[model samples]
Every structure is written in structure tokens, then in C-alpha cells.
Target chain A: MTVTSLPHDAALSARHPGELGLRESATFDRATIADIQRAAATGVYDIRGWGAKRSVPHFDDLLFLGASMSRYPLEGYRERCDTDIVLGDRHASKPLHLQTPVTIAGMSFGALSANAKEALGRGASEVGTSTTTGDGGMTPEERGQSKHLVYQYLPSRYGMNPDDLRKADAIEIVLGQGAKPGGGGMLLGQKITERVAGMRTLPVGIDQRSASRHPDWTGPDDLEIKIGELREITDWKKPIYVKVGASRPYYDTALAVKSGADVIVVDGMQGGTAATQQVFIENVGIPTLAAIPQAVQALQELGVHRKVQLIVSGGIRTGADVAKAMALGADAVAIGTAALIALGDNDPRYAAEYAALGSAAGYYDDFQDGRDPAGISTQDPELSSRLDPVAGGRRIANYLRVLTMEAQTIARACGKSHLRNLEPEDLVALTIEAAAMARVPLAGTSWIPGAR
Target chain B: MVTLIGTETPAYVPAASGATATLVDLAESTVRDLNQALHEPHVQGEWTVTNSDGKHSIAVGIDAPVSVTIEGHVGYYAAGMHQKGDVIIRGNAGVGLAENIMSGTVHVTGDASQSAAATGHGGLVVIDGNAGARCGISMKGVDIVVGGSIGHMSAFMAQAGRLVVCGDAGDALGDSIYEARIYVKGTVASLGADCVEKPMGGEHLEELGQLLAAAGRTEQPSEFKRYGSARNLYHFHVDNSTAY
Candidate 1:
């Protein structure tokens, strides 16, 4: 198509090869990228679960105020930003009190290896937070190892008992998770070994399906009865929490309160699952940014803000992210993937082995197979050994400490005395996506579209 | 003392002192008084009731080897926390009947509601009629035998035990059921997330025969079908989504 071309010297005159050359000059918008991707693909890649692999507009556009205005900055080393969180209200005789806001979310014994679960509990305990048992059932090792344990009352009622309820520091009624809202837990047959199967009380080597609804109750009123039953079982000693996915969170949060839930755990679209329908995970729930503000609004309307703690979780990766979440009105944050990372997921050291398994370091998505190199997702004896519980726990604790520190740093910069004082007014959004989702003003402007 | 006025006695009466006592309280008090009067270290007796109305948590937490009889319908958690007791309900029982029973026998003369014999450890629970959802859920060492059909997700996540249903089973039967043997007579509507239908051979038939006999149902064992795990989706494999 080109009849004539300029000399190489002339063509390269405007820029250095190292600067804005082929690599740097390559610019394509979303449409172009999509077109290229479409043309390049020979076949569809079948994958399960929620979350966007490609970069999507997230809460990154938001920034925090460092120590400046009305707030005094805490000394990074000397001064403390309190991380303790008390879940549930005064009605609960034994509320869930944690030393850190970063609690471990539920991962069933059947979905994850026993060692992995133990490591999670150990690590969370080391960090002064809580760990939760998943749908399979409560194991003595898990309950005994964790300093503070939250027992999950799932739809399937697996391993649920009054003794465990009484022993637990808190009770979490898992209405739904963000990754698979309106869906149930699924443990395929390959993962159901004798031990795993035995733990769940199913025949060894069978696919385990969890029901979508609780057997005892069908609606919100019934939920109250269930909560009452739980309270009776525990003598109203333990805090009762209701966990729901981000879909229609405002209504769900309100309903949970109506159902006498002491704490509300709001899980957003970015949350992870051991295994879920690919369509359900990615398409069913709202983003965390949108869900948080609505959840806060619901609690505020109920005049129970801060009394009924709101724990928000989904794609929380950095200290800044944690700070932003808190500023947006989350009492605390629970992390799953990041915690797994701190426990050594996608480590560069395992790059060769991951490659041998037809996966890359960061692309190791085979969590349902139980062949995890990180030892967090597998039941295999050898793979699980790759993770040392004590060492892994130490690393997680260190990471949590860093996240808390970073959050405190920003909270102080915002001129707030405590992390909770870092309000939404202290931040602005850099992108329309975040501005709308987070309900904040655009950077360098006072305009909030729906604000009165 | 409250006396029965007629042949058809009322199902229940709240205590005069306004205590939140269940039917089990009366049963326990009766047993305790009987044992104290008898002055015997232990006593074994079979008591039968002709009519049982909906009564909650009947025969709860009984430790003695005494037989309890209920003539008609009963309510939630009947025979709850039963230890070394034999509870025979002549009619249908509500949810969580014989829940968490440790080393006991619970015989239902009629159907059972949801979660029948839930989480019972070391017990024999026999339901003559249809058992609702989550029958034998999370049972540890208990053996549950249902003469009729079972609802959805029966025996869900049972850690260790055996469930024998003489009729059809609903969807997600044995979902996440672990190491528990389930035998059904009619077709299972659907296997649970990881569960699969397995061949019921001579060994399974023998085991089924024993369970049926224990439940006081010695009918033909050949009519029952077996279900178990396929062991495919235990780990986080990329290609295992089909089973999930």
C-alpha cells in the first residue's frame, strides 16, 4: 500500500528507539483491544467462578488524605491505629472481639486441604483476628487452633451442632457469598477423599452438593426463628452475623437487621470461591464499591451504625484499598485471595512447576483440582507440604501488620484521630467508574451526580 | 398433679409454675422418680404411648435405657440429645427428630419432617413414612432407615453413617454427603454436587439387609439402590467444573 518510505534516520529522528518506539507507542482503546482479542482467539476457554481477569475500573481511582487537616498523624512505629473490631451488639453476651480488622473468610475443609485450613486459622490467630470454618463442617483441629473462630451456619447444615455453636466466638449465617450468589457449594468427586468425605459425612469419592436454602426456614421471618434457635443453642452468648452477597445489598442488609443479625458481612463481586458456575460468579453480583455505600446507608437508616458492625470484603489488595474501604464506611475488611497470596500463592519460585502443569505463576487458576503449588487449595499430601504452617502464618501476620500500618498512615493524613474518622469527604474519585460506584466527587471538582 | 380427664388425653400442658419445660422434662422427672423409688442402679423398661400430638423436644437428653412411646404426631427435635434411650414415636415427627442423639434408638411410626435424626451419633433412627429434607444430616455414627420417600438433600454432608430409604429421593440427595452409605428404593431425582449413583452389589445388599433389620424393616433388600461419591472434584482442577 505504501509507494514511498522515509529514510530510517528521518523516520527515527523524532524519537529514540528506547522511548515511544514500538513497545511504548502501542496504544489501543478498549474497543481495539477487544477486536484484537476476538480475532486472536481460536476457541473458547471454559473457566468457572467470578472476577475479571483483565483490568477493570476499580476503587484505585480513589485516594486518601495523609496527615494534614483536622487529623493528627500517628507515628508509623510508635503511635497506634487500633485494629480491634467488636462484632455484634450489646445483646450478645460474648461478642466477637478481634485484635485486627483483617479476619479470615470461610474456606471449607473439603474445598481446601486440612493443613491449609489449619494454616489459615493459625495465621489469623497469630495476627489477632478470627478464622472461619466453611460448609463442610467444623473440625476440632480448626476450632482448637484458631484463637477466635467464627462457625458458619450454611444452607446445607453440614457439621452444625450446638456444642460447636457454643464453643464458637461468633456465628455467621451464610445467606450467600459474593462469588456465587444464589448458588450452593460444590465439591466434585475427585476432591472427596476418604478424609475429606468423612469430614463431610458423605461417601468417599462422590460429588458433594450444598443446598441453596436452609432446611428449617424459607423466608426472613423464618430466618428470625433460626437465629432464635441458634441463640437458644448458645444461650445468647455468641454474636450472630449474617453474611450476604453484594446483589441487592441495601435490602439484604436491612432484612438481616430485621432478622436480628448483630453483624453484617457484605461480600461483593470480586470475592473468590473454591468452585462455582463461571456465569454465576462473574454476572450475579455488584462490585464492592457500590455495595459498601449502600450497606452503610442501610445501617445508618436503621440508626444502628457502628452498633451492628459492617464487614466488607471483595478484591481488597493493598493498605490503601483497606483505608479506602474503611473511609467508605466499612468497620472492617475480610480478605480471601490476598490472604492466600500472603500464604504463598503464585510465588515466583514455583514458576517452573506451574509452567510444567500448563499454568503460569500468576495464572494458576486450578483451585478446584486440589493440586495447588501454594498448598492453600489442595488436599494432596505432597503439595500441601510445600506450605509450612508456622512460617506461612508469620508471613500473613506480617502482611496484615503492613496493611494496618498503611491504613493508619492514610487515616492520620486525613486529619482523623482514628481510622473510622477517615470519612468519605476526605477522598475523591479520579475516574467516572469509581466516582459513580463509590459515590464520591470527581477529583478537583465538587460535583457528586446524585448528591443533593 | 395434673390428671388425664378422658381416654383421649391432651397432647401437652404448660407447667403450672410457667416454666419453659418440654415433654422431655416430664419424662425425665417420671423416670428419675421411678429410679429413685426402685433404688436400682440401673433399670431397663419399654413404655409405649398410643397418641402423640405435636410435642417439641420430647425425650430430650435422656441418659437411661428407657423406651419412650408416642402414639401420634410429634414436633421438633423429638428425642433430642438422647443417650442410651429407646424412643418410639407412633406417628410423624417434626424437624430434627432425635437430633444429636448419642447411642439411642428412635422409631417413627409415621413420616418425619426435615432434618430427621440430624447430627445423631451412634443411634438407630427408623422412620416408617416419608422423611423430609436433610434426613440424617451430619450424622456421625447413627444409622437411619426410612420406609418411605425422602425429600431434597437428604443425608447432606453426613460425616459417617448409613441412611436407608425405601422410596424415591428428591434432588441433591446426599449432597456433600461424606463416607455415609445411602440406599434408596426408587429413583433419585438428582444426585448432589459431587455424589453419583453406584452399583449395589452383594456386599452393599448385605449391609443394607443389616441396616433394614436393625430398623425393624426386614423387607427385600434388593429393592434398594446405592449412591456414593465419584471422587473427581475433590481438588481444584481446571477441567473439573462439570462435576461442580
Candidate 2:
């Protein structure tokens, strides 16, 4: 085959020998150019918070197929629709029973303030769902407030203790995160407070790099041994959840199941991070919309679908997103960035403070700096005092209520009694990418892009 | 408070101190049953687990300050996440021995497998024999001492406390270590990441001496070389990519 230059590239190359203007077919975009210049100016790679900013296939690319002439619709006001869910029923004596499928995602205390963590606990408790503790370990404030708490067992094992493990309602073994799969966690010196340092047994004001791989087990076989150890440690009382970034959901899900996990948590490309290299955040892992079907297929192929619960996270913003995720076979959905917003992370009310930080309310993503104007992601005492946990908890509770109600509304309109009953047949994709990923038909047609 | 005499099953002997002493024979009891009996509220007693048979996760999640002695070889994660207890393993231990321990003491009389005493906090762990790879990995405020040589990557990313290796250390000793002090009496194959050899100052000598005493070793502090963090990668810099 012959390689032919595009018209724009040919025209640009014709004048590039003396031109001061940018090339029409420039390989680097404005953002890429900025990143390159920044890297050249500062030797270190850029580290920040938040998930993939560039657009990809997402829930918005799909829509629900509402009841029409051929299908009878339920009365919206009189119909009853359920949104309840149960997790960890496989082996745990006491499983998690939630009023809704929406639950809080894991966010560490060091990355967030004590008040913010408390708010998450309170909000999740009010809705009869669960809240999770991230990398640094569980805090007293979080445990006292959350009705059901899931303790994260990361590769770092920071502050991991038997007492905390026993106190946890469930245990989540973190393999990786969506923002930076195959990458370690980073907590800059600025965020390491005295309490945080003491808890993690690190010196104050020192940067910490959590290990990417677990110290004990290496592969799936070793993982099975480790899972048995965890079960014995907890006396087979607490449920074990294996969480992984959605890079190879099918394989990861199968391995997790084989390792005797009671639940599987898949976080996709859009999952938020407290701090990480910007390149890893922007260019790692598959999208949530694409990860769900792969994970479901793995569970189904293993004959463990719904027997082992699946909780999908990453850029899940609304009740519509939750409904779509469940319709695609996710048992539940988790939220992090959106929950922070409910707790006032980037409220327009903090616009003046955001301006002082050289950013706007809606555009802020520098959670790693620990100078957050909204006080949600800071270790500074004065800044952390700005947030009120009680009020924040109330706001989050209201948001959760809205999401549950909206999901119920959709389920009723679809003539379904339970959210889990809203199957893939009740949905249609607006784009070929979403259609293929979700394994659903395209709008106004019976054609599926890549179905067997 | 009942003692069963020697019969077809093993005998349950009670201690003279009047504290309830529970005897668990692995030949007849399950790990779940033993752990459940140990976790009972207000059950303050001594526990002796016999015939461990190299089983993984023996005497794990012990919350109260109890004394537990294992008579034979134990498998992976032996005494894992132990707190407020004294656990003694009479035979060789498997991988991740005493891992993630908090506020407890785990004593292994024989050789230990990989990742021994990893991520422990507020505890003391003593391994009388050689330790495998990643010994004391990510240790936090937990003092660990290996009476014999240690395998590769000992004290990797250890955040605090002291690691005393009476014998030689394998390659990549103390890789990416932070704050934790390492003392090795024998040769070190290599250093890794941001780890380096540091001068054993007067304060370090005193500290090493104390760690040696705690680990029940009579070796001279001066005989060991001290290793610690170089503080090069403490803060992120692209120039430090080689260390990463």
C-alpha cells in the first residue's frame, strides 16, 4: 500500500520551512502542547486528581426504550417500583441490604478531610447503603458515623490492623484503580498531616508512594491463598470484595471469583483519583460503559452471575446513569466525584475562593495540591474547618434520595417492578461504540454492531 | 473451666493460674471453630493449638491480650493481623508471617517464608531463622529482627521502626525505604531505588543496640552496617526517574 499525505498535512508541510503559524495538521493539540511545555519547564511529570477529561463512550450514548403503543405502560403515580439491592450474600453471615443501588465509593481520609469522610459515612448511613475507606485505613470518625462500612485492603497495607478489619462490615481487596491501572498511589507531602503520618507510620511532611502490587501474593493462585487467609482472619464472618480497575474486566472478574470473592467491584476509566500522574489518569483503563458487559459475561460464563454481586463505578453522575448501569447487568453502582460535589467540593458558592486558587468552581481538579478552596480535600486545619459535616451529610442524603427516586421513576415507566429487571432489551444505544460495548441494539433498528 | 483427661481424643489441660486454658487439636478442630472460640467476649485465657500441620492463617485476628502457642509448622499469614496478644510458633512459618500485625508480638522459632512481618504497626516480630524475599516490606512502626540472613528486597518501602538482620541481606535491600533504620551484620548484595548506606552515628549505634537487645541478639551494633533513605525521591522530580 502507498502512504499518501492528507491535503491539510501537504499544505502545512509546504510552508512549514519558514512559517510562524501552527501546522494545520499538527500532531499535538493545544492541551498536548501545554502538557509538553509544562513537562519541559518542570522536570517532574504532572500529578493531579480526577478521571479522564477527554470524551469517550459513556452512558449518555444510550437511552431507555420507554413503553409505547405496542407495549402497555404502568401508571406513573400508582405503579410500584423497587430499587433495593443485596450484596455479599454468597458467604457472609450478615450481608449488606441497601434501600437503593447507589452507594458511596472509597476515598481515603488523608486525601479528604476528617469532616468530609464523616459526611460520606453519615450520608450513606442515612440511605441504608454503605461507605468505604480508602488507602490510609479506617478512621474513628468514619466508623462511628457509617452504619455499614467497607474497609479497603490496598497493596500498601498502610495502617492495616486486625482490629479495624474485624470492625469493618466488609473487606475490599484493592487490586488497582481506574485512573491509574498498574500504577502506584501517590500522596504528596503537603497532604500528610500529623494524624495521617501517625496512622501510616510515616514521618510528617514526607511524600508517600503506595505499592502497585501486593507484597504477599503475586498471581491468581497466590491470590486464592490470600483470600483464604482473609477468610480465616475474619472467621468467615465478613464478606470479601475484590476490586479492580476496568482494564481487563472479564479476566479480572473471573480471577476474583475463583479467589472466592463474595463481591466484585469494577472501576472504569472515568473513576476519580485523589492524586496520580496526569498521563495515567487520562490514558488508562476502559470506560465504564464498556466494562460492565465484559464483567457480566465473565460472571455468567462462570455461572456466578448475581450470585456474586457486581458494583461498577467511574463517572456515574445521575440516576439515569445508575439505571443504565444496572440495565447492562451491574448489580449496583458507586460514586466518588459526584458525591464530593454533593458535599460541596466545587459549589459555585466557593467561586471567590476558587478564583483565589487560580481556578473556577466547575473546572477545579487539583485535589492533590491539598489547598482545596472548598475544604473537602485539604489537610490544612483552617481550610478543613470550612466544611460542616452535618450540613454536608444532609445535602448528600438529599442527592441520594433524588437518584433513587429517579431510578424508580424510570423502572416504573419501563413497566418493571425492580431495577434489576430492567434488562438490556429495554435499552438502545445511540452510537455504534456504545451499541457494541453495551451489546444492545441501535436506536430505531434491530441491528447490534457486534453481537454473536 | 472443664478439663478432659487423655482419651481417644487429646487431653485438655487447665493452667494453675485459674485462667481458662483452651487446647485446640488441628486433627479434630477447624480453624473457624478455634477462631470463634478465641474471639468470644470476656474469655480471657491461654490457648494452645497443636498439630498445626503447616496450615495457613493460624491464630489470626486475636484481639485480646492472650497467649497462643502453636506446636508445629504453620503456613501462610500465620498470626496475621494479630493485636494485643503474644503468639509463638514452635516450627517454621510460611509466607506473610505476622503480616499487618498491630500491637502484638509474634515469635517464629524456625525459618520464615516471604514477606514476613510486612506492614506491621505497633508490634514486635522476631524470626529466629532465615527470612525470604521482601521481609519487613512496608513495615510501619514494627520492630523486626531476623536472626539469620534475609532474601531480596528486605525492608522495601519500610516507613518506620527498625529492622535488624544478624546475617547477610540479599539483593535490593531496603528499596525505596523511608524513615525505617536497617542494620545488617553481614554483606549486602545491593541497594535499590532511593536506598543507600548511611553513617552509623552515635544515636544510630544506641538505637541498633536497643533493637539487638529487643531481638535477643548479643551481636555488637558496630559490626552491622546501617542503611536508610537518601531523601532523593521524597519529593517528585522528573530527574529522579532513575530511582523510580
Write candidate 2's Cα lDDT for A211-282 as tens digits: 999998788888888888888888788899999999999999999999899999999999999999988998
Local distance difference test, candidate 2: 0.88
**Worst ten-residue run, lDDT, model 2 chain B?**
B1-10
Quote each prediction's TM-score: 0.76, 0.93
TM-score of chain A of each: 0.88, 0.93
Give per-residue lDDT, candidate 2, residue A387: 85
Give lDDT tens digits, candidate 1, residues B121-185.
Answer: 67788999999988877677788899989999887766677888888899998876566788888
lDDT of 1 by residue, A1-452 (tens): 22134445655657754543333324775545754685457232333422545454567888765556665666665665666778876468888778777788888887777777888888888878989989887888898789999999887666665557667899999999988779888777767778886666566776566777665556787677566556644556789999998999899999999989999999988888887755577678888888998999999999988988899988889888888998999898988888888888888899988898777888776677677777778788888888888787788788888887788777766656567767898889888778877888888887766766
Q: Which candidate is the best by DockQ?
A: 2
lDDT of 2 by residue, B1-244 (tens): 1232222321333434455546788878877677777777865556778879998878887888888888899998988888888888989999999988887789999999999998888688999999999999998888898999999998999888889999999999999899898989999999978889999999999988887887788899989999999988788777778777
Q: How many residue pairs clash in each candidate?
A: 46, 0
Q: What share of the true interface contacts does candidate 1 keep?
A: 0.22
Runs off by more than 4 Å, candidate 1: A1-45, A48-51, A54-57, A66-80, A156-163, A188-191, A202-209, B1-92, B95-103, B107-110, B114-122, B132-142, B147-213, B216-244
Per-model DockQ: 0.20, 0.69
